[model samples]
Each structure stands twice: as C-alpha cells, then as structure tokens.
Target: MTTTDVHVFFLLLCLFSPKVAAHGRIPTTLDGPFSPRTRRFDPSLRLGSDDVPMDDPKLAKKVGFNFPEQIALAISFSHTSMWVSWVTGDAQIGKNVMPLDPSTVGSEVWYGEESGKYSFVQNGTAMVYNQLYPFEGLLNYTSGIIHHVRLDGLKPGTRYYYKCGDSSLKAMSKEHTFETFPTSPDHFLRKIAVVGDLGLTLNSTSTIDHLSKNDPSLILMVGDLSYANQYLTTGGKGVPCYGCAFPDAPIRETYQPRWDGWGRFMEPLTSKIPMMVIEGNHEIEPQARGINFSSYLTRFAVPSLESHSESNFYYSFNAGGIHFIMLGAYIDYNQTGAQYAWLKKDLLKVDRELPPGLWQLGILLGDGGNIEQIDIEHADDPGKCPSKNPSIPEFGGICHLNFSSGPAKGKFCWDQQPEWSAFRESSFGHGILEVINSTYALWTWHRNQDAYKESSKGDQIYIVRQPEICLANIAKVSSKDQ
Candidate 1:
C-alpha cells in the first residue's frame, strides 16, 4: 500500500480500538469530514429559563459608597500591561435622577509583584453615563462612577497584588491578585475560556460555576452580556425577545440597573482573569434621541487605542504568543469601511511562524445560558427554519437564502442535518481552549449537566494545523508585500 494509505489505515485502527476508547482518546480534525451529529435536547430541564433576581448576593453591591465594586481585569495590547476596572457609588433610577460627580472618587490602582508591597501607583480616568427616555411613563437612570486604570511595564507571567479606590478617602478596596500572560511563544497561556450569550440566569450560574472550576487564564465574551434591554424601565422578569414583547413601545426600554447587577455577577471570575468582549445585539439599549450603548461603552476598558483601532466596538490584543482579533458585527464592515481597513492591517502583522493562520472551522460557543432561551432552531431543520426578517436586529440586515449546493441543494430548509455540521446540541455550556504548542490546540466543550459527572466532557477535540501548506501561503503573501 502507498504511504498515505498505510497512515490512514493506522489512524482508523487507533480510532476504533477499544483500549483507546477506554483511555478517553480525543479525536483530531484530521479524523475526517465528520458526519453531522445532533444530541436530543433534554426535556427534563426547566424550559422557563428565568433570569436570576437582583436580590441574589452574587448580583448585589458588595462595597460601601465610594469604594470599588464590580472589579474586573482586562489584557492590554501586550503582556507588559493590564487594565483594571471597577465601579464606585450607587446608581440611581427614577425621574429627576442626578448623575454622580466622577471627580468625587479617584481612579487608582496600587500594585506590585509582592503582596501588600505596592511599588507602583497608576491613576486613570473616571466617568458616569445616563440612560434617558423622553417618552411618557419611562424613567431616567444615572450610573455610578466607573474607573479604569492601566498598570504598565510589568514582568510577564508574574503574579501581582493590587487595590483600587480613592486611597486618600481611606476607601481603598480589599487586595486582589492577578497573573500576567507569558511573553514567549514557546510557552502557552494555561487555558482560555470562551462563552457567549451568557445572561443573568440560574443556568448562567451553572455555566459560570463549571467554567470557574477549570481556572482559565483568559475569557473571550462574544457579548449578549446582560439582557438589560429585555426589561422595562420598571424592572420585571426578562423577556425572551425584546422586539416580541415590546413591539409597540415608543423606544426600546432598559432597566440600566441590570448592567450594574451583571457587573457584580461577573466580578468573581472577571476580577482576576481578563475578559475580552465584542458587542452583540443585546448591548444596543436605545433611549432618547437615538442614544444607545451608553452603559456598555462606559463600563468596560478595552485596548482600543493601544491597537490603533480607536473604537471599543472592535480591537486586537495579545496574550503570550497568541494574537486575538475581536471584530464588531454591529459596526461598519464593508470593504471600504474603516473597520475593514483596520482588519487588513492587523492581519498582516500576525507572526505566521509562531502564531500561524486559522483554518475555516466553525465552533458554536453561544449556548451559555441566557434568558432569551437556548437557540435550538436550525435553519436547515424542517418547519424550524427561521423566517426572513423573523425578528428585527438592533443593527444590520438578516438575509435568508436557499443553499446553492450540498444534500439540500436549492432548498431553503434541509430535511436532515446539514453535512457541514459536525456536532450540534441544544445544551447550555462553556468552552475551554488550550494551545499545546504553536501548531496544536485543544478545544473542549463542558456542558452544565456534565457537572454531575466531573470527568464528562460534552465534546473534545484537538484542532490541528497544516503548517506546511498554510505557512507557504503566508510566505507568498509576505513576498507580495515586500
């Protein structure tokens, strides 16, 4: 037999071996163009998927006035710097609500490699935002002071302790610690957790609990964060879809307090590990005079200027040897647009030898429990295909087209699962990504239900890279540029 044929035979034997199965061997991408798989949704789980109430200790304010609360960390452009953020004072909601003076509270972070021995002090800006609705029966909301301070020129892969607050007022926060990502390509970040559409729900807690157990170094939150817009000015149970519930409302109503609650909910995990975020439709909380995304913009600190993108909606950052490009779906993405131009420039700077290029593979990480309900409907499923313009997006267009090729040729909906889908499940979960080396990375999905079975992983695989072919293509692109 030919060499390629012999290699294939050995791979098939190893994959089907009972011993390998018992040993929990993870399949790699080279395994095949896998057949589509659909795990049946569990009916036993409650379908209501209600939002966790604000009264929960996890969502309540933990600090006194002018003291830092809802603290979080974010990666700067590189490992030499890290961004620290938190909120101070109480947010107000109602008519005639007065905005907090950010000047009242100082934004500072005192940090050093050793515990309680701060050698460096960094001061940053503080700001507050308001969400207003001019229509009748709607209330205006003002936010607490949001602070973001960047700690710079630090040793990579080292632990540091810090506190944030107005030190002069003796309102300093309790000490917190975080480790920086390594700068070398030879070493990898411990683990990177990825989740999307995570709302404030019981299922969300399960997902977060499962993720926290894994102890990830970084988090990539692909947005749909708080679901704040799912409620009215007078807070109530979050709706599955804002448009469906408030079709005739004058403007999209938002209980801005939900954002604060979400900040508090995420502090436990985000305070140490940096969470990089991109905007999702749920973040567009529209209010008076076309104002939108006020809370989202003011609350988070991202490396926009460091990457030269200059927009919080999209940016790029590095952790260890890996470079991450976060694109904004809600922003201008045309070829002639500024975002597109920035993307082209960013792509050219990738270190092809160390970080390498990505292949065309789609991994859905959007099942992180949201009150909007788990997205189980497939465009290819019979009678389950979403209608064109089924719901209006806060931004952008939705186009539905019939498949030009594949088993369901010329069809708007497939009778069976599409061939492109490797595995599909309607369960809430989060994913962990671990780069074993420059060329190999492990991607594992952990289902919330699997918490009962600690050893159980819903799906696991090693995403392999074809360095010979892909790197050659990169060389050609480099030659063209030269």
Candidate 2:
C-alpha cells in the first residue's frame, strides 16, 4: 500500500481499538462518568534522588558579567508574540549585601531571520530580588538584574535568531535561535512536554535530556520549578531532610543561588521554546514577618492579567486546539472566594465550539494543603487511599479543604474517585496533548520511570468535543431567568 493508505489504516485501527475509552484519566469527551483506576507506584521508583551540586558545569555561569545568563522564553497571549527573559550581573550573598541597580544595565534584544543582521530591536524593563534573613548566621541574598522583553508582530511556525543585553556596555548574549508555535489551529504541534516537582537533580538532567529529544514546541511545568528552599544557605550542602534536621530553625533554610543554577541549566532549552509555569509548593520560600512566595512571584512572569485572571497562581492559555487551565492549589479556592469567582467566569467564557476539534485539559499540582487535594470519590477498589500526605508545609500555605457537597462531602479523603475527576494518579509524570482535528485530540501521559523508547504510557485517550451538547447548554435558560 502507499504511505497515505498505510497512514489511513493506522488511524482507523486507533479509532476502533476496544481498549481506548472516551474521557476521564484517559482522553474522553464530556460523556464521562467513567470508573476510576489507580496504578500503584513501583517500589524501584520510590527512592528520592540527590540534587545537582552547585559547582556542576551545567549550573555554572557560562557568560561573563553584564552579559545575558539564564536566557528563557514564555508564550504571550497569542502566538504572534513571545516574551524573552534573562539575568545580567553577579548575585551577592553575605550578612550585608546590596542589590544590583537594574537601571545601571540597559535591557535590549536584537533579532531577525539572518545571522549578524539585526532587523528588529526591542527594549524592556529590569529589576532585582532579594532574600533577607535578619537573624545572625543566616546569610542574606540578592539577585542579578533580571530583564524581560516581549517580541511582537512575528509570524508563527517560523524560526528567529536573537541576542540580549546592553550592547553599548559590551554585554551581549551569545547568538541563540527559537521557533514560534504554528499559527493555524488545524496544524498539529508534534510534541509538548509537561513535568512537575522537577528539582535540579541527576534524575532531572535525565528527564530534560529525554524530553529534549522529543522536540516539544512548548513546555508546561506543573510546579516546583526549583527546589532552592531544600537547602539552608547559598551554595551550602543541601540536607536530605529539612524539617527533620532543622526543627528549631526560625524558617526553612533556602539556597537562593540554586534558582540561578537552575536557570542556567534550563537556558539551553527554554531559550528556544516557550515554557509556561504554575506555582508549586517548593516555590513558597517564606521569610520574616509572615511573608511568603517571594521567590516564585518575582522570578517568573505568567499571563495572569492577559488571561483575565488577577493572580499568577492561576491562568489559562491556548495551544493549537487545546485549552489548558493551570489552577492554583495554594490560593483560596472556596466557592465564595476570588479565585473561584474568577474560575467560574473563565469557564463560562469558554466557547469550546469556536476551536473545532479542540479539547480541554486541566492540570492540578501541589495538593498538600486545603486549597487543592486528591479526589478519592471513585477508586476502583477500597483501602488504596494514599497513607502518606506528601504535603510539605514549607512549600506554602495549606489550602486543601473538605468537600462541602458531592459523594465525598464532609470527608478529608474520598472513598472512591470523584465524578469530576476522570483519571487520578499520584505519580510525577507529564502529559502531551495532540489535536488531530476540531473534534478529536489524543492525550498521553508519560511516567518518569518509563524508558524513553518503550512508550510505557500511564494513560492514553482520545478527547472528543461535542459542540452540539455545549451549544445546547449555552442556549438553556436557568432558574434565575424565570
């Protein structure tokens, strides 16, 4: 048979597979009230890995002072624009430290399709952040001048070359290149990587290397961008257990420099592809006077305002035909709270029918506290509830609360899987959503333990959109209307 015919045959086979079901943990349509399944974690994968040391070459500052370091990219509200960010200057760590004057170094980006030929220029703003510990023996920390510039009026599915820093100061980044996402919703983005709780560890390097080979157009870091708080001081030896070893400490010790190290390590990939991040518990580095989430709030820029959400903790963005909503589990999520109100409005605004064949994917991370917790309403079997609460308080405030209504109402843990939860697993894995058409999309989750070539998928499903049903709901009049 010809290549086209073979492709058609394979497509038909996938569509007809009996093992494939519609919606829930597996990809499915709104037609879900499906039974839930939980796969036990393999004993071999339970051991925690060590973080990459500060002195590692990959984590070192490759560029000189005043030159761009930790270069990265993030998606704007649309594919036509993208945000590029980086740091320039030396961070200070001592009892008495001064922050770099952001104005001292100008922030600029020069780019075009050709090398050494600057066709476009964009200027942006810069600032520095500090982690202060007033108590003696605990070192205070300050970051380098961080810059963020947005590139606009660009065509999608096209590659662009660029460099950043103060050109007049002889501080310019090495030439780097990145490709934009496809403009057409019908076109498929080959691979999109998703990962969470990815500390700077040897295993993290392995994960990054494997994900790099996949050539994902975008990356969704569900949370825990950098486990800097796991350490007591900048560049100090990170203890295996923080709460166990440092019980009497005023606050959990954090190695702020690790954030820079992580940035340097991820620059190679992030410089080219857009990465969207959500706040994880590890990001909530607390300080004096009841302060919290300082590191997370200052380091990354998310589309909270652009997406119409007021807080960075939660936001939504579109990739091809998929609409992804990243929720904040650490913030107030009660039905009467601001986040809940915002979410309701956001959900009401979605015209899923507009993006023909598009599917909706909601990813939840950091379920320790009262704001967001695992839904246990519909487990396939009893006595399988997670015994250990992995909710580490140092990461952030407790937000997980008991359900007021539903089958699992008034209970801290659900007896079975919740109706709203299609598939629930407590493993660290990333998912990829491939939009095949306006009506059908393929969803797959890859567990970290699975070999790169083996394709040992944790879950796979085809998401089907029913515009007819959605439109009917939109047309219905509520009791308030009467």
Candidate 3:
C-alpha cells in the first residue's frame, strides 16, 4: 500500500476509535480546606425580609374538616416505598380548648396513575399533639389530626398521582402528583437541594420558589425549620424571643400554627418530591414543664427506625448512588455517647461496591445554645480548630461540648478550623448533590443570597471514592477475625 493509503487507514482509525471513558478518581483530604472565594452580600438580599403572616390566604386551610392540609412526602428506608403525611380537622387555641380525637377521622390514601381514578387504596395511622402552657395569659393548643401512611412496592422513577383523605366523610384532597427517585444507582438525578436555617420569611419564599423551579429529585433540610418559637401564644402575637424582652414573664410562648403555615407553604414542592429533615436548634420550642421539640417531633416523619436509628434526631438513607447520613448536633455526640456509637457503626456499614460510587457524608451544625464545651475544647485547640464559638441565642440547645482529647484538649474554643469539618460557613443556605457517575459526584452549596443565580457557590467539590481504599479496610478486618 502507498503512503497515502496508510494515511487514509490512520484517519479511519481515528474516526472509529472508541471514546475514552472517565472513571473513578479519588481526592485527597489535603486537596481541600478550600476557602470559599468570598463575595460581598448583596444589599438587596437583606435579612429584613419578614415571615409570611399566618393570615395569608395561601396558608389558610382551603378544604373542610377531614380534608388534607399540610400535605408532604418523605422517603422510607428504601426505594420500594415512600411515606405520605397530612393533617385534618381545625386546630383550636384558647383557654378552654377541646382536643380532637385522632380516631374521629379515618386515615386513608387513594392513589394511582390515572387522575381522578384512585382504584388503589391504602390505610394508615393518625394522631394529634397538644402544646400546653398552664400559665396566666398563655393560650393552649391542640393540633389537627395528623395522618401517616407508607406506600410500598413502588416502581422507582415512576409518577403516581395520589389523593389522601377519609372516604367515609367524603373529605378527599384534590389530586396531587409525585415522581419516585431513580431505581438504579447509575441513573442520574438532575438536582438535590439542601438548605439550613430556612425560616418562613419572604426570603425563604424566594428560596423555595427558585428551588421548586430547579426541580430537585430530593430535598435535605438540615434543620431550624420554622421559627415558631418567635411567638407569644398558639394564635397570639409574634415576638423574636419569648422572654428576651420580658425576662420575668411567667411562661415561654410559641405560635404553633406557624408550623401548619410552613407545611402548607411547602406542600407545593414537598407534596411532589420527598424532603428529609434533621433537627436544628429552632425546633426545640421549650414549653410546659420544660418539654421541647414537641411540634418538630410530631409534625414530620423521618426514617429513624428504618435506618436502625432509635430516634429521629439522626439517621441515614440512600438516594440513587449517594448514601446520606444526617447527624444531629443537638443530641449527644460524644465519642462515647449512644449517637456517636450509632454513627460509627452506621459509617462502617456503608457498601461502596454495590453502587460503585463515591460516598458522601454530611454533618450540619449550628443552633442557638452553647455547643457542649467538651466537643469545642477539642475543636478549638491551636493544632485542631483555631476558631472561637460565635454563639447566637436565636437558635436553642446546649449540646456543644469541649474536646476531651486532641490538641484543643480542655479548651472551650478551637484555635483554628476543626479537622473533621471539611468545610464550614455561618451564613444560612442550602446544598445540592448531583451524581455524575458511579464513582464521582458534584456537591454545591447555594447561599440564600445567591439563590437567584449560580454566580456565588458557598462551597463546591467533586467527592471521589476509592473502592480500593475502603475494600482494603474491609479485607483487613475479615483477615483479623480469622
């Protein structure tokens, strides 16, 4: 063959050669400690945005008694099932209030593919919670009947229309729709929005509106859900702090109905997509005999038991190729505590082989009270964390502790950033995880100020997992047992 013929053959080879595939790439811990390139907060995005008032028509219960209000969805332990929850009946607030028996209303869900055709029926459980303030000038509250039903055997990535209510009372909700997460770990999920300290403010409305349009497959709410504690009574006035201005007040107060309003506002997005929440300090609304977190514990359903977590304060779940571990800063997290023990075990159970994807672990920290000095002492050592606690009382709780060991041993503040904290930012914002492939995923944190555009990313990284690294550890353990 002539030289021209050889050149033609080489061109053919270049045109037909298979494209090189990008696979697993592991990142070193040293590759980070990345300082988020800072951008000045836009004057337009001030914290002055007020909370949407309860009387807003959008929050009012549109349907009659037994009709579903505050409708939302949450994932169960696995992709084969999901949970649907809603509230019914009129919540009452007054000096002499009557609690509605949960049994007074039937708990049921009617769902199927075809609209207006719910041939499939599922029955579930219901309950009511009360927030009592046995003090003069303080009002009492009994919630509407809340319903929770788990729908199982669902085909992932499939859409199913659903309506929940009491068939007997003809109190069914208007048809609502939701799509399941992708069944296969390899399948790509467009976006997963994450946020923390999301109070029900006008700014929050913008955040939710933008997030809804982004159309995430999942939502991870890291806590401080509603600022219900910033009120005087169940149906009374809104105050920034219960007794800050009135130090001698006889009772701590809360506007419990704000929670209902938050739920209703969130229904537009949460009803269609699953939202997984972890407690934040704002959730600890102390009332009656020092009872706390009553509204938070009752309002949302989490996969605590399903994930082997004895309490809802912390848990773990999987979405597509990602394994998410939600930790509770308000709970006991000492290396020797129950939550810490559970966390260590839970981390050990992560299986990177089946999915062959990068494992991402996330921790959300911040609340109004002093984090246990024990954890902080370790966190604040000159060789550990070199930062002081910027404590704010708006958030509640007293779980922060000083480190018992490490360079910061016995100190109350870290001299620098703690090693375990891969990244830290104080501004209120949310995060999103986009799985690009089996061994690689992209994570981004969008500050509330940057919600409109992607210009400012508070933190972003490509999390990579080396199966070889984790598998070797597993193998070593197996051999040691032998």
User: What is the per-residue lDDT of model 2 for residues 1-482, given as tens digits with 9 covering 90 to 100?
Assistant: 00000000001001111222234454365556676545545566643456677889999998788999999898876667778899999998888998889999998999998888779999988988888888867888999988988888877778899999998998898898888777564465556676666677766776687677777888877777777887887456665456766776777878799899999999999998889887766677887766778777777767777779889888776554345667777788776688877765665556433423223345343211111112222322475544445436764355556668888788666776556666665444456656565566676766556777645776777767675774465456322233
Candidate 1 residue lDDT tens string, 342-432 = 8667766654233344432234556778886765556556677656557665556676888788887887768787676778777787888
TM-score of every prediction relative to native: 0.90, 0.80, 0.78
Q: 384 in model 3: Cα distance from truth in Å?
A: 21
Question: What clash count does candidate 1 reach?
Answer: 0
Per-residue error (Å), model 1, residue 471: 5.0
Clashes of each: 0, 23, 37
Looking at candidate 2, what is the lDDT of residue 369? 14
Q: Write the per-residue lDDT of candidate 3 for residues 1-482, one digit (tens) a residue.
A: 00000000000000011222353453434377654232334454455546677878867778787789899999887777788999999988888789899998888989887788876888888988888888888888889998999888788878899999998988988899988777553465567776655667765776676676667898877776777776768454544444554565565577788888888888888898899887766677777777878887888888888879988888877665456677776777766688877765665566422433334344242311111100112333346543354334433544567768875678666465555555443344456666665555566666555546645666666765565785587568656645
Error of 1 at 383 (Å): 2.3
